[model samples]
Target chain A: MTTANPQTNETVETIHEETVETNHDDHGHHEQPPKGIMRWILTTNHKDIGTLYLWFSLTMFFIGGAMAMVIRAELFEPGLQLVEPHFFNQMTTVHGLIMVFGAVMPAFTGLANWLVPMMIGAPDMALPRMNNWSFWILPFAFLILLSSLFMEGGGPDFGWTFYAPLSTKYSGDSTALFVFAIHIMGISSIMGAINVIVTIFNLRAPGMTWMKMPLFVWTWLVTAFLLIAVMPVLAGAVTMVLTDKFFGTSFFDAAGGGDPVMFQHIFWFFGHPEVYIMILPAFGIVSAIIPAFSRKKLFGYSSMVYAVASIAILSFVVWAHHMFTTGMPKVALLFFMYCTMLIAVPTGVKVFNWVATMWKGSLSFEPPMLFAVAFVVLFTIGGFSGLMLAMTPADFQYHDTYFVVAHFHYVLVTGAIFSIMAAAYYWLPKWTGHMYSMTLAKWHFWCSVISVNVLFFPMHFLGLAGMPRRIPDYNIQFANVNEIVSIGGFAFGLSQLLFLALVIKCCRGGEKAPAKPWDGAEGLEWEIPSPAPYHSFTTPPEVK
Target chain B: MTASTQSNKKLITYLVLGCLGMFGFGFALVPLYDIMCDTLGINGKTATTAQAYDQQVINKSRTIRIEFMAHIQPGMKWDFGPTTNVLEVHPGELVKTAFVAKNNASKRMIAQAIPSISPGLGAKYFHKTECFCFQQQPVDGQSPADFPLVFFVDPQLPKDIHTLTLSYTLYDITEKTLGEALTGPQAQGVTP
Candidate 1:
């Protein structure tokens, strides 16, 4: 309190005066949060909204995981096993939809809701009510999507990409529901992104200039911009698909002078940036965690920021790499191929920065650190495969194959999802006011690291051996590797239960954590009391 | 009202506008992609209308083998095929080809043909001076109708493209034209 400068004092007074006028209950006192279910339903507090988003995301993760279990179970042998092909297609489509939109995105948003304001020393999210609305609409959107599976002719079997004609002329009635769900999800994302950008721009305490802001906040700023820019494009794509299917328009129909391949162009334009949206926040989270565990300053901090910006810009131009087999002009093909390879440079910069941060520094392996380190190693493998797939000639063999599947799973599962686990472990004590059991945490990390690799590693081989993805049955040649993948899938699915238990046990109570549980941790969030106040920074910290 | 709140309001407006702009950009991509493809002569999109045939530009040394393919889009009950499966012609020599369409449906129908040229680099070079695809053809369903196509390839086509395939997909437009007519000058509460 004594460190407050004149500017900080004036800003705090202005914030307090505004808060008093806006929220009567929050007036200069340690007020209790509201009672009962309404506390969550109508809550404007960032922490409450954060909790809702996290719990919803966890529910979706398991639901999506269970679908993956069905997939692995069916693929265990080869020929026609558990579910019908029609239903298996639905499983893959919905599983991807849920994990991408319902699980990973919401989790990052949840983290932003919890961490951004706290890290920047703000009282709350700038637009708290909008934050609440964003979280609440997500469940309904997902509900509409999940319910469509039982409709006549099953759900959208046209793959998550939903390329035209298959989605237009061939898909079932559930296409409408899928479109509606995507629209709602897009709206939620745009609103959430707007809230994050506004908060980061306007809510930082005095002396917290752009450069002084935490890397997590900086990354979210970029991520929020990506969301704002691309989510609407996705919405536009789904709208065109809907019109093409129902309204007799031919946005994706070739007979009406519209190219079905155009749909792929638009979809991947949104999609490539979207993949970066999922991973950039992971970069921020890992950046924060690695430096904390290594007890060293992050190497090339400014360059890390530049690397992320460059990667995001590159994502917009490199979308056609996904469509190398679509028979684009050779020159166009080469352009996309080289641009796709160019992404690895900035991504390499990030990996090197993380390692350099750990180089010759006092390093200890906490549960969070374990996941972060695993993320660096495994995500690079995914990156290498992605580079291989980026070669226009090699992509002809690998396109739509299990190799493509393995490449993305390595990046998404071990890369994005692993970073999420690292973040959860890293921030659990701060969120819960109690240190988690290291024994349980370590078990979750070890089981996940081993089982996840077993599950996704062989997929590269299956893909390499000429096995296409999204098929209900495979050739006898793929039997052994598929078996290993299935067992690994089951074990990895079960391994998450340990994480579920760890989170629950920590929430209830373990050992009471101090305000800053990790000795090496930094940022305004650490400066706040443990469990993070229901309303953080009633008086903003002087950031000097 | 705080200064930051006022800035937040301004900032939110711009961000939301950016969102809307990107949405429009998504739709814009459709035309932009088409235009880019047309200019580059990619995606196998041939010129929609006929072009002037030039005699002086003829290249006698090049004898391009032009192949034709016909497709009937789903739900259109019509048998459609190219009359000549393949033709060998010197560049700039006007060649006449025809597609036979027999409407098998019980009722009379109107059909439109959409053209695509392969070795997309050769698309712009293949000009249609006169083609039945320029207008919808009315098929009476009793006898097969021959739809004439008149075209000549430009000598400027890439030297590597020795063969070119021009494919036409036939679409049933009876319902669409009928609906438009019912809404337009011809509508007098006509049921069929």
Candidate 2:
């Protein structure tokens, strides 16, 4: 690798000498990355780690998507044809775990790793070594999680929420492994988040004041704070689950003065903010993309920052909305209900800002722009369903049904996951110094956009018609829609392979990209050369 | 050390402290949940304090049917049920009921019963004056134990709720109690 890249060696030596002359600091001892796989194993470079995280997330997305395929195949005809009920439960559970932790969260972290420093004109992450450790721990964490499936009793069959009595009193022998895996994932997220926070705060270029920083950086700052605050709470929750399962603790046992409902309270306390952690970065990505495609400055930039912070704060009190059917007192129900509805305000502000940014400008539908536009419309549909679910009395009818499943998949799959796809398309040129095949990317987008709706749209009707979620089979009344859904699911699964091929093609070779790939783009990242240098901003640039 | 490095260290310290503080807050929710439940009178959590039953005035104009339900948690080796499944009583009139529990295991076991009332709005109205669910019951091997519950429906119970289901789920607490006993020096007299 060193022989292949003499330019990188010269750049590193120049940075080292410059660092020595400017300040006697520890960073002056920079070394060349080793040849072969050792470069990845022992690398502390942010771009390398970001690549690792992205690849890991894509691999997990396929794994989780394959599990979704199994579910659709089983539900294809609504009979017990593909797998046993026990195995079906495991598929649903592990699929949720992998997608949320292994795919979406890591993908955002990957984007932050790559973009935050470049956007702020920093040398690297605040703690580059910790960044490597954070990325490395994730593979092992997911390995432990996936390995549990082949265990004697099979992996955790409880839903991803893993409510007690089911997870504690009646879970299989692999609950310990599941708990430990979750703990490690939490550690990884917390460390990654801490690095993002510190880098953004301490490493910004001279003139990149708080307001001048890119919206992505600002949103990630809030997101990192949320992660640092809540990931530890998740650690606490899974620890209690481990003890309740193996040790003689009764934290969730009713007979020993413990209430199972208390478990939901703790989990959702960590869980609700966690949902925002997955989405706020999407907001940042979409905010970045909408303007680039529309040739406009982001509408209401300061308000966007305030809206994200408010949403983060409001996330804490609205968790009980998930438990409206648990029979909380009328007053408590009203309080949570109102608080959940109050979240719509800031969210509305964000949606309006995106629309305002795109209103009547010279809009073009590149693959990234297409995904962002789809996100605005489809995510609003998800938001409307969420609003309906927030009403206490209405939730009594919708709880634990496919309606609930439809609501989340809309936000998660279409909202967060689509934003990730858009970010990849938008940044591929900058990272690879080549433009990806636009034709294949558009095919990937259109196939995904249509089939994904065909897959999840019927779930709303199924839920409204009283089909409960997490079940292996349903009554024959729901058979036809399930068939359509399964077909759509398979098509959607196949479309992602095109994305994989596009990425590989871009990385290998394509049309050489200019320094500024997008005509309307504006950022410090755009100011830098394509395939951003081995060490960025060794001498920080002035933003203004 | 440079000022930037010092400030970075301070920020990291505060963030690490915040993470620890949030972890503690998660555990704090345990007590906070109990306090919330007690104050809201939701989730069928009955009051621990015995109530004074008002026998002076009985609302004979209305009759409410009360149903009893019993469940055994998995891994609990005990046979338990309510002596009476259903009873009709006038509002404000105290009623008494009994449940029989027999240890099916070869070894002595301690069990605790958790009570829940359905149509959860009826929880505050259905006051328990004396209930076996308030304490743990330890039964020797193959012995049967009868525990009684004394409660009354307050006349103020909503007129719409004419029927209520009171269910008790029994769980084995032997291991936990044994651990506590061992630490308290009471295990010397007992054989495992």
Given the true complex, what DockQ would model 1 score?
0.65
Winning model by TM-score:
1
> Residue A248: error of model 2 in Å?
0.3
Candidate 2 DockQ category? acceptable
Write the residue-wise lDDT of candidate 2 on A118-166 in tens digits: 9998777877778989999999999999999998999999999999979
* Candidate 2 stretches greater than 4 Å from native: A1-32, B49-66, B74-80, B85-93, B101-110, B119-126, B138-145, B153-165, B174-192
Shift in Å, residue A28, candidate 1? 9.6
Q: Which residue pairs in candidate 1 have backbone atoms (N, alpha carbon, C) closer than 3 angstroms, thus clashing?
A: none
* Whole-model lDDT, model 1: 0.89
**TM-score for all predictions?**
0.96, 0.91
Q: Write the per-residue lDDT of candidate 2 for residues B126-185, one digit (tens) a residue.
A: 988888887767778888888788999999898889998999999887887876643454
